[model samples]
Target chain A: MGNQRDSIGDSSAHNIYLTNGASEGVRQVLNMAIRSKEDGIMVPIPQYPLYSALITLQGGTMVPYYLDEPKNWGLDIKDLEYRVKKAKDEGLNVRSMVVINPGNPTGQVLTEQNIREIILCYENSILIMADEVYKNVYSEGSQFLSFRKVLNGMGAPYKDNELISFHSISKGLMGECGLRGGYMETHNIDPFVEEMFYKLKSIELCSNTIGQLGTLLMINPPKRGVEADEVVDLYEKEQGEIYGGLKERAKMLTATFNKMERTSCSEIQGAMYGFPRIHLTQSAIKAAKEQGVQPDFFYCMQMVNETGIMTVPGSGFGQRDGEFHYRITNLVSPTSEMRATLDRLEAFNSEFYAKYSQ
Target chain B: MGNQRDSIGDSSAHNIYLTNGASEGVRQVLNMAIRSKEDGIMVPIPQYPLYSALITLQGGTMVPYYLDEPKNWGLDIKDLEYRVKKAKDEGLNVRSMVVINPGNPTGQVLTEQNIREIILCYENSILIMADEVYKNVYSEGSQFLSFRKVLNGMGAPYKDNELISFHSISKGLMGECGLRGGYMETHNIDPFVEEMFYKLKSIELCSNTIGQLGTLLMINPPKRGVEADEVVDLYEKEQGEIYGGLKERAKMLTATFNKMERTSCSEIQGAMYGFPRIHLTQSAIKAAKEQGVQPDFFYCMQMVNETGIMTVPGSGFGQRDGEFHYRITNLVSPTSEMRATLDRLEAFNSEFYAKYSQ
Candidate 1:
């Protein structure tokens, strides 16, 4: 059952449906819509692969909008309009826009104003799929602004816009990725369509019940007495430890990247990832091509070989032409180990550039 | 992770993958294989909904071959070849065959010889997708013989046949449907296809870990010391209780259905269900058409309304033309309540037949 929206000043959680996981929730909702290749869904470039993969798996066209790097990888309405119109011009029906706030890989949280600008752009026509799984991960300055809250902030008719916001127990402090538990909350959907969604989900009978209980434990935890206080106190203490540690690591890593010869990183506002641009030399790009790999991939592989630190290539997420980037996690435990990894990365980059530079 | 195939005499479980459930395991494999509408998969008539639902969702043709009802819902190789040839004649690429042992809805297990004929028919060409989730549920006389065992019994050439066998903790004594735990073991599959499958599964990252542990506990339960003996003793005691109760219910329900007017059920060999064929009059069929419902659906709905017992219509499980049936579980706890329900069903059938026997 889906009643998770009331706090956002919309209808209650009665519109919420538990999914197999965040990915499954996204897949089921997209599977409910996106009938043919004629229909397109907007996704962020350098997005989580699940979004793009499911789109192709469901036989729908993916219309990608790049996150603006200068603006700290924030959504620019211009890019949205460009991608939507570009897709429309090709005779594709731009039925939905997928907005992953507190972005994956990039790790930038959306502003309330940014959310408003997004909703207002296609409030009436396009369905908004907000992947708000990282909403609970509070950042340094920006508090997580749910799309439902921003939609409610617009008031009146904006609340009537079709939205399916997904939340999960997989991320955040719980980090129960293997639990495979998440939920989808829908707003302003027709009762008939809602029933249809229920029937569609029933095809697999139901999502994992234990995962549902895990989500329950998450939303409704021990809160009051000695027992409650003990659990809550321990949870908050860990949160504090991780928050302070991760925030410092984010700053140190960004500074470390900028100090490097051809590396620069945008701020890590929220989420667990830090996507840093690695400026590749022409000769390095040539070496990558000769190895039949993207420059960033080749560079990341070499870094992994040398430093024993794994990273995903920027091309894996989807970067602009001629731009090179790599995503690393803020999840590195033991501060010294993370610092050591960063130090090795710096050394490896210098060696790599010297070896492959023109 | 997929090393569960060793006990069954397959090459190894290195070719295995974990899934959300038996259904999801079946789905991922089918989704990987069935690429276009022109591609066909051989499904048993009156098969579980998962096969058809996924086949349609994955945009593949479902070519159904009927089971030999008189032979206790046994496999018929001629029917299989007929369906396959028909699909091929219609220009469909018949890529694979789906064999649900301890057949879902019907609840009949395949004989070792039956399994041999099935493999021998398509061992060279079509891939075999064996749903053996109910392999542990022993019947009155027939012990559950896995398709893998039969394939091995056929020796080398058949051993080289491509097979994807699925098993789950959802059925058997665990009966943890909502737990969502299962594994798929592939035999003699091409390495290229296995890599593709790994990439596809990587999209969702992993299945429910708690369920995975539950599966682990099932495969490697306690055996030696005091605590281990106590746990094992309790498990065996509960299993014995369920076994004694369920075996009685299966016999009772089968006899009950046979005694009822115009109703017949095959032996409840392995699975939890007893799919009974209900003979509907022509007038009832007309009435069902007037109500804009399938005849079996209408009959099952009426049965539910009259007896407060729910049964899934045969049409829901892909029944043959002109025949009507409904699938009900032998899981009605307490033999008395089941008998009372059966008595109510008998009375309802008499009254309905009196009214609709045109």
Candidate 2:
């Protein structure tokens, strides 16, 4: 749990709070900050719907800023500023921003420069709730950097910025999500806000004690050459294969989608999913409206109907208006299954597009 | 999962919704039914803090109906009706009622007739959220009865009552709280309400899959004469010992608390706790007020400070005006430790009372 603290040079363990999972931590932070309709949080467009769902559940307005899907799904500082101002103009009192690194659905690892800019962007009143569950899953060219690390490195007021960042054993090499284990560490939060977090968790009776123990074992695994050499070797070997396989499959899928006549996919820089934008024909859009569903949803439903494959529509995850994309995981097992999915997807794309393209 | 379900004789499993734990199910039901300050839920006074905490978190007004502590903490029907009318008069739209049977903190199990009457008392609009996690742990004279069973047993309008009753592997014979597993079954819920439940759960990406699977195994254990017959016998043997031990301990603690000079404890009809109301002196109340805390809180904190004993304050669980009590779990491990706790509590009571006698 102190792993994040070590990364950012925290002097004490007081900052870390173990949660039911990353989601619970996220809920607590959002719940603590957003007290009424006036409060809102900025979320990345095409985000993990958990963000949108939780915001709605907590009655907080979700102000979305579009990611630069054209540029490997990079953060667009200008777009985010526009969203903040736009939301304020609409009578929303925006208090926080949520940044998912190695983004869910988007699968983009943010640059260190981008992170620093995000911290410098928000005022002291706005807390940063960073969803870094996929921090350990970056692509080859990108390295996972903590918002805390970036903020601390910048020095001064940036170092003391209010930030609640999270990590999970559910993701990463461990993949023990079934156990529901995760931790959140805050950076320089006010004592009042800190007390509320404690009070909230005390009510949940401390988020399943076993999950916290599972996290402890994960963060402090048995040392190599200290009576666990064989275990360590096995862990390293399996972890290498999983990551290497994910990166390879992600690349294969993105390339395949890009090659399709009416589709383009941003690079899968990290995380498990690839979000591929589909160029829906006018007739397909018309057909979707007749069926009373979003175009991307209709497209995904068609693929599922034909090839027995399921993908989530962009609309379900909050996307830019008039754009259609679907999110698919790069985690298809038995390698051959992955190849077959791609083959079926390629065939379905051409066949379906030809039917409606004219 | 199929247990409260069996109580209602549901041919389909549509009613059952597995949750992260019983708390999650309870949270979801309350969240779905109560959307604003105009919405309120009738909760038992001296109830589980989880109900109070969750209702407060969701911004739902808690209309507390006092229990008859002298009558084995019996549900006072007239009192509940009065509370409901009062809340309505105050402009709160009370839409649901929470029943923590084998009550938490109170530890009183309602009879089947009581359960049926509760359903009849509420209009069609008021949903019933039954916290039956302790349904299987009734005292010798009491029998655990599901709200679903009572409702259906009456037939017609009663059979179609909107009810969400919870059960957990964390309680009963399994005692797997740290693993966090439970299920909630809805009886004759409107399709719209059912859709809302599904939508809300979909956001959390399905509660701890392992917990749900744990529940599935718990509900469908192997037959006695099956291939795993020996394992089944062993399980029964262990389970019997656990139950036998709990019953004995609960009996011993209730008697002990009653024997104390200034304390009286209601029967532990179900659940794990023995909530003992302590008669405090005027001086003690004054001292507590001087410290700026609830008298019960101050009393419990003093006990902790002096004797290293921790118990939940009655005020935390919502007690009658000016009454002081604290809750202690009867599930203490090791017979000797339980005895020591009892002995220490007895001696501390007299010593502490003498100090504040003036």
Number of the top candidate by TM-score?
Answer: 2
lDDT, residue B87, model 2 = 95
Candidate 2 residue lDDT tens string, B1-358: 4653355445357767777789888887887877788898999988888988898888889899898999888888889888899999999998889898888888889987788778788665678888888745647678888777777788677778787788887884647887778888877788987888888877775567667778887777656777487888888888777777777788888999999978999888878889999999999999988999988898888888877888999988888887889999878866668889889888888888998996
Instruction: Return the lDDT, model 1, position A125.
Output: 57
Could you tell me which residue pairs clash in candidate 1? A2-A13, A2-A14, A2-A15, A2-A16, A3-A12, A3-A13, A3-A14, A4-A13
Q: Each candidate's TM vs. the true structure? A: 0.89, 0.93
Predicted candidate 1 versus true structure: per-residue lDDT over B1-358, tens digit per residue: 3333335533445676777778888878888999899999989988988888888878898988999888889987898878777888999998889988889888888877788888877635689998888754546568777666666667778877888888888874648778888888887789899888888888877889977876766555555574567787987788788877778888887888888888998878878888989888889999999999999999989989988989899998887799888988877888788888888988999998998998
TM-score for the A-chain in each candidate structure? 0.94, 0.94
Candidate 1 CAPRI classification by DockQ:
medium
Which pairs clash inside model 2?
A: none
